[model samples]
Target: MDTGLVGDRRWQEKIFTGEWRDGGGGVLPVIEPATGAELGVAGKAAPDDVARSVARADEAQAAWAAAPFSERAGVLRRAAELWTEHSAEVRTWLVREAGSVRRKAMRELGGTVAECWEAAALPSHPLGEVLPSERATLSMTRRTPVGVVGVIAPFNLPLKLAFRSVAPALALGNAVVLKPDPRTPVSGGVALARVFEEAGLPPGVLHVLPGGADVGAALVVQPAVRAVSFTGSSRAGHAVAELCARHSTRVHLELGGNSALIVMPDADLDRAVAAASYGAFYHQGQGCIVVGRHLVHDSVYDTYAQMLAEKAAGLTVGNPAEQDVALGPLIDAHQRDSVDALVTGSVEAGAKPLTGGTYQGLFYRPTVLADTGPGAPAYDAEVFGPVASVTRFSTADEAVELASDSPYGLALSILTADVTAGLEMAAAIPTGLAHINDQTIADDAHAPFGGLGESGNASRFGGPAANIEAYTDTRWITVHSAIPSY
Candidate 1:
């Protein structure tokens, strides 16, 4: 097997259709975010490529869907094994192309394998239920595939995010057309094509296209695409939803989040501090479920903020390819500038910068802000960086109001020794996921995962239940032994 690294002879033409070929569009340079260097280039997909890919997928889907369940399950099971076998090469792509630290890269690799394993089980799950029928007939309902599925994934956590949708859609007998972000095409797109190709997925069942919004828009509106799965910013999600709606197509969205982590007066102080640190700084806070607000009870607000500040200051930030560090560089200068502007604006608007509020190049230091009042930039929006904003709440109602104030409601975490009280307060806030005595950043391959309100339209992915709902349509079937007099 070719390693597909920078110097690999096979890398120049990385697009896969059972064999490598130069894609429809020209070429796109893949850059290393940590250091300003071109790692390699990936083939880009043009408009004609989008049309041809979808046509081929439609042709392959019928035969693939007709295959035995055991055969379909076997493909995904093999993919899980292949992912682990190539972890070393995959990690290099992650660290250099996607700017992930070694630990974060390993975490993604492991999670991706778990996703494949979970998807492998989908083929054997019960399709539907038997329902009662009127007068002299036996009635039943069974799930059927929605034909071709279109997926658009972001740069952050590329492999895990893309495969979470791709694997299940394929397992349920639906073909997929995936559009990974152009910036991190190697890890996000080409590598996935090779993994599936090696796993013996039939040709044209999966199409990996690396391009920008133009390619994504084409996929969403394509007449042959019956459903679409999108994961990105809330703004982009809205655009995709509108396009799908115009075409009468089904869409599953996992969008942006400004989640909250609340600490009660009686909470374990050390535990609360640790949760906040990990929740806000893990992956440099680039996740949709990363904690955007820290609501601390007035009794413990001062002490908790002080402890968090100390922890932030102690964290190391540098290029992950160079040293062992807690945080790595942002995806690029645009991301770094956005994070810096939010912190700077909040500080000028009366929020106190307790620790780090600056950056040098792409590496922004872990920052903690105190007194982040309402309407402050970091307080009200999703700051996708290593920044934690702490606010004081006097009572339980005050805490609930503060947590529920954002337009985004992806996740919420409440911490207190009184479990009953924490659960009660968490119930008041409308969020897709609520955690007691835990942080906001969490995922399971066997659980329904998504958001609510502006975060998403309540469409979820993961687990057998959600996968069936997302990729299949239920149809009624009635059996009559003989026709009676009308």
Candidate 2:
């Protein structure tokens, strides 16, 4: 479905104050990455737009915070209903504008609904606790909204990434000013605003501004925005953190990952291969938690490599919207070139390309590289592509060392027949998330989702406790029937 041909007027405009309008920056053409065809145009916001959005959200937050908890929960519940009711339209936007495959788009759509439902529960949760005090008084603590929150979302998995923060912020009685990447404004920005708008979100409560780095910078520095939830590259994450730090604003960052998938000698070969293929090639490996390293025990390294290579070669690659292919194009040519450069560099550094090391247009084939070692680009860096670099490890210690070598500590997975051994290995690794007998690309809407080191600020973004902490400030209060001496 070309957005140009769609009849919905909202998709082509910027959403602010519960209404649609042209942006201050002019229009941005939405292009289909797979075919480089113009899907349509979306309003492009300028830096000035960010200021207006933050100012509006700040003014609207007080009334929203004072509304009944039931009203807040009802808004989120209605958003969930709208999400499911308009699933087909959202799926098309994801596939066409965000370059996601059919199944991946469906998964994102379902996850968005789950996020909304999980957020709805936030309004009714116990927000504070009674505390012991030194004086003769009842002391307690309660959470309060942080005024306006700024959400800066990325292109890949845009809908889920944006809403995971947006839904909770709104449910917690705070307004939000969202900045979706210009490359994927519709799926990440317009789609979300539409659902909330139709669900009866009030004016100035949620602003969807589609723009680039300039707009993001403006949003982060706005005095009215007390916090910012950012998801993007580690380089950009660092930049946002620095700006927020200077402004004394809280920041929650979900950045890059070079996750590892360790296969033990005693692992089931078929199951291990299946998990590896899925983790490495899901959404063309555009995800942060997708497998970046394949650490195989020396005893079964040859067998595992052969199996994975065969699986990679057999996957069909085509336009996701038109074909039921296992792999689709990268978001654009720049991403494709970056991925190819890493593969080429790794191969030149003596890594063997077991299946693929080439591409045509944006569709990079699922690649398997054997003998991947230190100093190789694909082995050491977060390539963020459908390239799996396999390295041989003789012992459990070696596997742990190899997986923990990178600066990133986002996610890890171990495939083994011995559950105890897998668990032990997982404990030794420093990642925030780990799986035994499973793959690395795992996320639950109700689970704490984040990472350590460069992957994020350790300020996670899901579940009741984390979301409450992310979107609100806890305050302590004391009650006394009589005046107490100082």
lDDT of 1 by residue, 1-486 (tens): 245433354645455544567778788898888898988778888777788889999999999999999999999999999888888888888888888888999999889999999999999999988898777888889999999999999999999999999999999999999999988887888878878887889999999888889899999999999999999999999999999999999999999999999999999999899989999998899999998899999999999999999999999998888898888889989998999999999998999999998888888899999999698999988899999999999999999999988889899999999999999998999999999999998888998898998899774787998999999999998888898787
lDDT of 2 by residue, 65-101 (tens): 9999999999999989988877888898899888899
RMSD of each: 1.5, 1.5
Q: How displaced is residue 407 in candidate 2, in Å?
A: 0.4
TM-score of each: 0.97, 0.98
Give the 10-residue window scoring lowest on summed lDDT in candidate 2. Answer: 1-10
Candidate 1 clash figure, as a count? 0
Model 2: runs farther than 4 Å from truth? 1-6, 13-15
- Cα deviation in Å at residue 452, candidate 1? 0.3
